[model samples]
Target: MPVMPSSAPSVEKGPTLRNDSFSDRRDSVNKLETGCLSIIVLGASGDLAKKKTFPALFNLYRQGFLQSSGVHIFGYARTKISDDELRARIRGYLVHGKGGPPHTHSEDVSKFLQLIKYVSGSYDAEDRFRLLDKEISKHEISKNIQEGSSQRLFYLALPPLVYPTVCKMIRRFCMNKYNHGGWTRIVVEKPFGKDLESAEKLSTQLGDLFDESQLYRIDHYLGKELVQNLLVLRFANRFFLPLWNRDNIDNIQIVFREDFGTEGRGGYFDEYGIIRDIFQNHLLQVLCLVAMEKPVSLRPEHIRDEKVKVLQSVLPIKSEEVVLGQYEGYRDDPTVPDSSNTPTFATVVLRIDNERWEGVPFILKAGKALNSRKAEIRVQFKDVPGDIFRCKRQGRNEFVIRLQPSEAMYMKLTVKQPGLEMSTILSELDLSYGQRYQGVTIPEAYERLILDTIRGDQQHFVRRDELKAAWEIFTPLLHRIDDGELKPLPYKPGSRGPVEADVLLSKAGYRQTHGYVWISPSL
Candidate 1:
């Protein structure tokens, strides 16, 4: 195990990393958001708040998205720290220019820091939430904003277990008053629940407290650049519209690989394992976008309706086709048990039973302590009808979308070698964002989602029915793993997971492209 990351404590708190960045979801931002906005960070002193939540707010502030005068930030948690102390704690993490390389802007950081005020409070207490409400109301009154026309965004950066009570408190004491031109919204993070029943129950709890429209079940993966691009790449391109079906594409693979182990955060990793931690929410969300039918329109409900259909169409996971592996040294973390059955790696194949995706397997693979760190989607095309040059031996035609560690998309193509004699070799048509876009700054996922919430856009956030459909597909497999009916195979760290996983991939009808790798092109 390696030394714990400073933000490791929050790993279990929530997927602060459930966060990513996004842009171009809509045609444009339209205009600055209306009303005086009070952004409240619940569980303020936690790692998720400091690392993901606070940094995201600061970024939005520096950008023109958050008007400094209208937005007042508040931090609420059980940690009894002074306002200055809380700001100082998170000061080290507030840097500018995320993605590629980072440089801190002290002036922007200090100004953003001043907007934040801390209030110490327990999660389940009504009085505490009321105090929070008082602070927010005070800010609104001081600004001379109308009593009930102030936007209140409560960001729950705490654990899933306390969501019910925290939400209840928000409902009873912290809502925007019954006034025109103002609304209250709550943004909750993922790890929604351990499985289907719990997820449904959590949904019921939150649903009862607030209307579906007022809630944002944020999964940062949806905010990813590539994931957001899937819609435009599919529907807008006439070339792909004819080719993106089971008749043309052979199989699809959405994979996530982490080159490092749990370090000192095994307690959280052990309980959730790789599947719950990555596959259930992240990979599955990506799959929905990759495989779903084009929506009737770009409206939030329309886009999400298609996603739910894809999830509902998914056939149950086959035990014979599933591969689970735990890294050899996973148990070394004092937080993990010696005899743990948790898997650090998982490869499962999902087949959608719809007209477009029938018989086409969607392979989902995720792991920790692997040889690489990347999350990507690979679309493998079927063999060419007439292979005159026998290019199949070299590689299949695959479109690889690299999500991170350099965002790029390239298509593996068979090209004629430059020679007197006729010859064919595999090459790629590449689009590296770094080289192509040059200096465009992509909005971080949390910042974008938060902005969406204030603007009443649910297109990028998960819907209630979508969440239930997602859990339905994985609940059985999760239950089997919990009962020990499905145990993880052991594999060495820094290696591609268990060899059997490759066998599973092959069985799922995905042909591996050997002896060729797509490197993100540099200028």
Candidate 2:
């Protein structure tokens, strides 16, 4: 529908024209099959790689998304392990079926493992990468793929400190340089940087080596089924369009909670805390999707452009409107410092100073070791101006979109009670995946994101400007917490959070839904 500037450089080579339909995009991706494809995972031995990267790739292979004969999977890490050891480490985490044994499909697992090879190397050394290149070349030669005929997809699953060096090594030694007909892409994990300055520095470093089109800065939340459905629900549904703005809505609550603590991972959690870990990246991305204007078209960059506009409209979070908390027994873990003041919980109010949402408040709340494990968006609509039935104070007519613990969308409404006496009760018009799509399997967020990277779709990935805008909103507050200028309130492990969070919401005209319990569709 739209075309990118001819003079502008893209990470993807050739003319930058937008695909008009889903089939068109699929056809474009399918057209890239001139040679073999190499999927190299850089941090193969780590928890993230084993838990997410490898399992996702295996699922793709099992589903026939990756051509069995033309593809090579390489696992490179500092750990000195055999190929069998690497496969064994990741086998348990690969998805089989719910509650099914991990080793159920022995044949499929064997076939997937056959494509995988392991390389032991230092992250910063060029010679080690040269060895890796040799291994990749061996596969290319066997497959009879000439230079520039194959594609290389490098996934950086390592810690942020090693990103620049590892990227440099991949660029210098491991890239597919034959110019016949192929592309090189890199997928980078989140927490891009701790703050704006560091994020910009990292962006600059990567920019020097790769075009913006070639890099995929991923936010796994965008890959969730419900998160992706936000667009379709708002634009396609007639019921939601008119009531989507501040005029008809009261406030929005975006929440994330976990029943489990960091366990022994406090060493990593203590540095970034809840705000950086969840609020800045995951929750903010969700907010953008919920609040952004309808895009010009379904093209990747078109949707991303609207997301950027929404982020740019958001004013910085006021310090007074923010509440930070540390859960009790946090420092008791041996990995946590005795005097550490990092926040395990945070709630902040963000206001968009734009035409559609000027006066509406968007409350973002995230915490670890709280009362329950759930993530959802609650959109409360404004009260009726005049109502004759002044019955009991029923909850407001609100839309609840559950992101996890169950995937569903339900509207809370006041309905007539089934009794002799005239009264009202809160009921729901629900659409839960469990009941509606019983036999269907919902892919994990990582699986979908990885597939998108392979297809070269950027709609669900976070762009560079969007990342910078998100950092700008939270950087000042992050600095205050880091400097000890603002001390976090303490709360018990199983409690909701500091009492101030409730008060903050109440003051901002939000109803708590204290007495209501969410029922999952399966139950």
Candidate 3:
């Protein structure tokens, strides 16, 4: 088991601090930036900032993850909006589905909104960024923070094309190394780059300005409760440790399916398709956790090092083992080109050339406009050598980890029928989260990841080399698709993607259970 860091820093003025509040206080050696802190959203007026970024910050603020007195939120963009206008715009989103209901939390929402200040600026204009710095400095001064002790965090919620300029502006104008004794951290979102070459170039650019420790590459999926539970379910479990390898497991599937297509983001989706959008990053990150060796310690670096090894061991992808499909109505979106061949669905079989995973296929399937909306990991164990009970016909023993909608970990195993007859049937050992963890509102993925960034933990974030290894694995296939050599097969919207996808899965040794479906247990 991993142990916590011996000590942690505290805020000068605010609710008292504790190590676990920032992190497990383990693995990472970063000092908690607990004093006067400024969280600047670089693309503040944008949709991402309004929808995810601000809402997450508000949750952290009310939960005391953020220092109410010393911490401030800043919005920066070229929209030329006032602080009050930004506040009003942000207010509309803080009241949302699970943790949000306007009337119940109106007072807290208002208070949280008040902590945010907005600054308008161009991505490349040093003078405009200089104004942003001034506002940040002014807020720190007002909070009684000394000149050399101010924590500045800038979140780039903008498109990647503008990352270089925005990063340049932050490094030149707002970095704590230049203006304060406290630290400066930047959180950037993904589609880190389209391919390996571009990803490395971007990394080099960011590396020149900041140490790797100061940059947090946020992947919200990693923060999901189930995904975060992967390590515990594996390393900490006595039974799974032996059966997780190629010997007992037949095949593993990590799936992501959505009930709706791109909506109106087709213009952007057309350029990257499903592989870049879902597989390369989200599915692959999940694969790392599912396939990696247990790290020596839970330190962020140790865990990340194991993930890197898994990625590095993956063999080159073969075309015959891949299935790509474009939903019939995908191009109907006005933003999508009439002749666009962008795939809304894809299933890629990745094989890791390592002792534990050799001969086992790690199938990652993702699609938009499917029959359902859910994400899950299914691990099917091989059939027993002697089927005396005749349970093989019932189905193979499979352990499933559902990642969303209703979180769960259930095992489908053979059991005697509940009757006075001598018969066997497949039943589940269910741990449906809704029923098992009633009244527990799982924190939003963005909320948890943002907090980790504040805590300086990278165990859940992608490491630089890890990102490089991932891009290298998919770059060849991506280039082939771009060159129109590997065309996407067409499939109807709302259907299981092209039948060929299923055929590929079967050829790769995946057997679907017949006559039985596992329903999530209700609360």
Candidate 4:
């Protein structure tokens, strides 16, 4: 494991003091001159690059975060394409306004596209990377950037299989050898590896090629506004500090559901099931935030250290505690093999053995083609024990942090009915972001993460040790399911996941909210 830095500056004084200190640091860092930043989007012709990466860059450019003349964008892939063609392909996905049609082919779009240039190349070939380096250097020289003053950022939007070869190629032929007084950074997308061993191997290989500070493994969930607010909600609020653990909390559910299926894109989904795709990285990361101890400070490494400790305390998942399912029509996809037993849904209970979370079950559930589309963290607090009121079966007081479709944090509490009947009813203290932030636009996950990379903040990115520990908790169960040829139960489209999931939650003491269904505000 890499050594952590000294504790971050103390925040116990007050929010004002901490905010001022952070702002000062940020201003100083942002003012430092790092000349001619070159952002290279590998796999530029692929869906991820066009749909997410380019759109994020365009938004940053539009907002004046990226320097107009000192920054350049490069699109690289194996497909032969012209600069105009590449720009045209990604223009439609770029978001230009709120509640309005995209500004496709407009003046702003054209201007943003002007900074982008395309280059076709093979992933493993040294000559291609050398050519890429030359293209980058040409831009720097034209801008009169000094040799040792420019920075380079490479975003790998490619498949995992090509990671090693591409990283090796970039290291050998593309890295800034002129010292660049600036940095070379690579942003990697996840499913970092299929399992623990492969993840460790990949880490080792990358470790040999680049320093840990230069590598960023991204999980987009961390960039969501509500997800980021988790820290403030827990540490800054005295209300939650006393009830965050096993003492007052009964159970916690971190759920992810999609209303749509793979849409014949099972070629990739079949290899790694929903567990690897969602539970292993995204949901688990959320769990860490929900359960981790307060960090020594807000520094990235300090926060990560607490997360690592929480993950380390989790007990191995028992076989009987897991439920896996395949949505109906999954195997019917042309890209999926007939005999494939890949799971499209999975729910597993993880128990942390540490004192704070000893008895509380942290249930993680995710599925595609489910009854609803939502991602949220639900904290069910223990029922008001020894009630003096006449309501015998009152609902459990719960706090929910919604992380998608809409962003909000609300608490469910029991209160008396307004009338003189002295009746009890469940009511919510809601803080829906849509209603609260009215016309303000929330930046997408990719936008925030990309900006973080530019600013060198690792707080929202995964560290190597955290990745390894996450795999350690899940790999054994994954191997067992594969080796045993565990046939997942089948569930119909547009329905909740398999019945087994409900049973699993019930056995672990979670009851669904009786009459509540989340309706998207836009809908």
Best by TM-score: 3
Screening candidate 2 with a backbone cut-off below 3 angstroms (N, C-alpha, C), the clashing residue pairs are 11-213, 11-214, 148-178
Per residue, candidate 2 scores C-alpha lDDT tens digits across 1-523 of 4343332224443222343334423443222223578899999999999878888887766655664477889999999999999988887776453324666666777888888999999998888899999999888888897655577889999888888899899889988766554678899998899999999999999989888888999888999999999999999999898999989999999999999888989999998999999999999999999999999988888999999999999998888899999998899988888989899999999999999999999999999889999999999998877766763366678899999968999998878889897877778899999999886678778878877776677888888999999999999999999999888999998999999998898877797564566698697
Candidate 4 lDDT over 319-379, as tens digits, reads 8889999998999888899988888999999999999999999999999999988999999
Q: TM-score, each model?
A: 0.93, 0.93, 0.94, 0.92
Model 1: pairs clashing at backbone N, Cα or C within 3 Å = 20-445, 21-444, 21-445
Model 1 lDDT tens row, 1-523: 1121131112111101111234744333433443578889999999999899998888777765665366899999999999999999988888534633344477788888899999998888778888989999889888787544577889999999999999999989998874554678889998999998999999999999988878889999988888889999989899998899989999999999999999878998898989899998999999999998978878788889999999999999889979999999899889999999999999999999989988899999999999999999999999998888877788789989988868889999999989997988889999999899877776778887776776677788888899899989988999999999999999999999999999998988888877787777662
Q: Where does candidate 3 stray beyond 4 Å?
A: 1-16, 19-34, 146-148, 177-181
**Candidate 3 colliding pairs:** 27-299, 148-181
Clashing residue pairs in candidate 4 (N, C-alpha, C atoms within 3 angstroms) = 148-180
User: What would the TM-score be for candidate 3 when compared with the true structure?
Assistant: 0.94
Candidate 4: residue 433 lDDT (0-100): 88
Per-candidate alpha-carbon RMSD to the true structure: 7.5, 4.0, 3.8, 5.1
- Model 1: how far is 49 from its true place, Å? 0.8
TM-score of 2: 0.93
Which one is best on lDDT? 3
Note the Cα lDDT for every prediction shown: 0.84, 0.84, 0.85, 0.83
